[model samples]
Target: MTAAQFRTVQQPLDPTAAVGEIALFDAGGNPLDLSGGGQKITSVKATALAAGTAPTATLANGVLTIGIPAGAKGAPGTAGVGVKSISLTKDTDGNITGGTVTKTDNSTTAITVTTA
Candidate 1:
């Protein structure tokens, strides 16, 4: 020990501001079961979900309304097994412009629509 008393001691270049306590591990290293009741692990600030200016659906007589596409409204068949015979030949006409839907075991499914 003689290179002029071997002087070399300098370590504190912003060492994470000298962290006080943060030892929590569990991926087989055990010791991280936070007690199951007083949950504590907090530090989260990065948010962006508040840009508002575009939501118009007004109708006060100027009439701007759109919504009338229907299907899946078949319930109440128990008095004598009623809907066992209700076929729309397919065009339930919610508007694709063509129709065919016959299924109660007679099996006949073909409803095509292709438009670009």
Candidate 2:
């Protein structure tokens, strides 16, 4: 849901009923100068996302792209389910030595790789 908010600036009226054109009163029974009929509003929100499959996005240059990458398309056929989770063992280093990936059938796949 997108919405806009504006801060309301209002002044209280006087205690006595001696007014003519809805006199503007402040908190201390003072008149207010609302000559400027323009109110300062927050920011207006953008619209919702377009209709389509989910996509990857990137935020840069004061713009948010919530769709497929530029000039990039989906590959043919469906992707096979594999590697739901991976647990890698590191030797005092942040290099990816090897990891285990879980499949959709609750089975784990041992993955061994050398990083140099």
Candidate 3:
């Protein structure tokens, strides 16, 4: 096509109320993405954990609070190599009564705990 067959003009587009949809196009007449803040949004995925009692979930003022399971109480990790013996004394009912934990380090720190 010759130059005369093409025309370039700038026209203001101000649609009034009750008008139809508004479509945006690029230089090549291809439909441009103007969905999410004038940018392209491919997918959106949100996951929410299941609800519970002791460990409940709360959301307030765009903030989320999730409760995690509490750690084991009155228990130490595996005794290190320098530990001589990690003894735990219990009664006949299997209830933990008391214990004496000893570690064979240079300082030899000994700890004793009694619940009964």
Candidate 4:
């Protein structure tokens, strides 16, 4: 008696489901990690300063003055020609209340200050 042989069959590919939430890619087109506990993202509003076209202020005579709108309170005034160390005093609210400026070098230095 001769035994019957069974033929092997190939399965058909299913193409019904669609992909959800496409993965993010970097500038080099590489997949980025989107898992939890990854890098923290902080967003700042789009301001004039953030744009690259903003005009920068000029530094004159070793002084860098920032351009703030009028009626705005300016920063604390600084004294002394050469300041090296700064002393700070904190208030009850944990804010800096006072500060003292000291000269960078000793007064006995050979460098003389000539007043014009």
Candidate 5:
């Protein structure tokens, strides 16, 4: 091909409008197809790595896999102090008379509810 045969060109591609399709090429400069018979992602897999390990990703034979380090279970969660359960005292008519909020550390707080 002569230099005169090659000229710079620019065109807007509207992917959503099905205006154009991307061209694919192989390592040897051979053109590839993007149809069902062409190379495509066939599988995906993820694995959790060690706590101190770094995250990584890889693609091979149409398979894409990712490896992410499992976060350190977060210091055993610091023994949550949030409410564990709420025991309510109800009347015969199913009215809430009073209640107690029990926390995760076995601490309790009495709750007085007024109904109209």
Candidate 6:
């Protein structure tokens, strides 16, 4: 049976309260019989597989084991620099020629601008 066939059970007002019983139903709203030789999940295990591998699941000895592939690690990122202030360089006609970007750590970088 698929997980979609079972309905979710809502908890009582007190989450710590003991549950008397759980009812299982199908997608068609039909109740399932839990009478003869009903099996209970005894254990669950998860394994990490190599990157690019597909996820898999298997049931054995009332235990469920799943294998999940790990995603590839991305390249290292460049350090971020915060801007603190900027100083503009002006030409003879008071037109902006370029500027200097001052970082939070007191470091400065020059920037060029093309006036339109």
Q: Is candidate 1 or candidate 2 better by lDDT?
A: 2
Task: Write the residue-wise lDDT of candidate 5 on 23-110 in tens digits.
Answer: 3344454554436674465765777889987555554677645666787775555555898999999999998899999998899999
Candidate 1 structure quality by residue, lDDT tens digits, 50-82: 234222221223232222233445678754322
Q: What is the RMSD, in Å, between candidate 6 and the native fold over all Cα?
A: 10.8
TM-score of 5: 0.36
- The ten-residue window of minimal lDDT in model 5 covers 1-10
Model 6 C-alpha lDDT per residue in residues 17-85, reported as the tens digit of each score: 754343545456676554566545576577898999856555456555667789998999988889999
Candidate 5, residue 33: Cα displacement in angstroms equals: 14
lDDT of 1 at 13: 54
Pairs clashing in candidate 6? none
Regions of model 6 farther than 4 Å from truth: 1-39, 81-116
Which ranges of candidate 3 are over 4 A from the true structure? 1-82, 106-116
Clashes of each: 6, 0, 0, 0, 0, 0
How many clashes in candidate 5?
0
In the range 1-116, model 2's lDDT, one tens digit per residue, is 11122222556656597432333333454544435652322322233444464333322333333343234455799767865677887767666777788888678888899645
Instruction: lDDT winner between 3 and 4, please give it.
Output: 3
**lDDT at residue 66 of model 2 (Cα atoms):** 35
TM per model? 0.14, 0.27, 0.21, 0.21, 0.36, 0.38
Stretches of candidate 2 exceeding 4 Å from the true structure: 1-80
RMSD for each of the candidates: 27.3, 19.9, 22.0, 28.6, 11.4, 10.8
Top lDDT prediction, candidate number: 6
Candidate 3 per-residue lDDT, tens place, 69-103, comes to: 45445667886657677677777999766666566
* Candidate number of the best TM-score: 6
* Candidate 2, poorest ten consecutive residues by summed lDDT: 1-10
Question: What is the model-wide C-alpha lDDT for candidate 5?
Answer: 0.62
Model 4 residue runs over 4 Å out of place are 1-81, 105-116
Clashing pairs in 2: none
- Model 4 earns a TM-score of 0.21
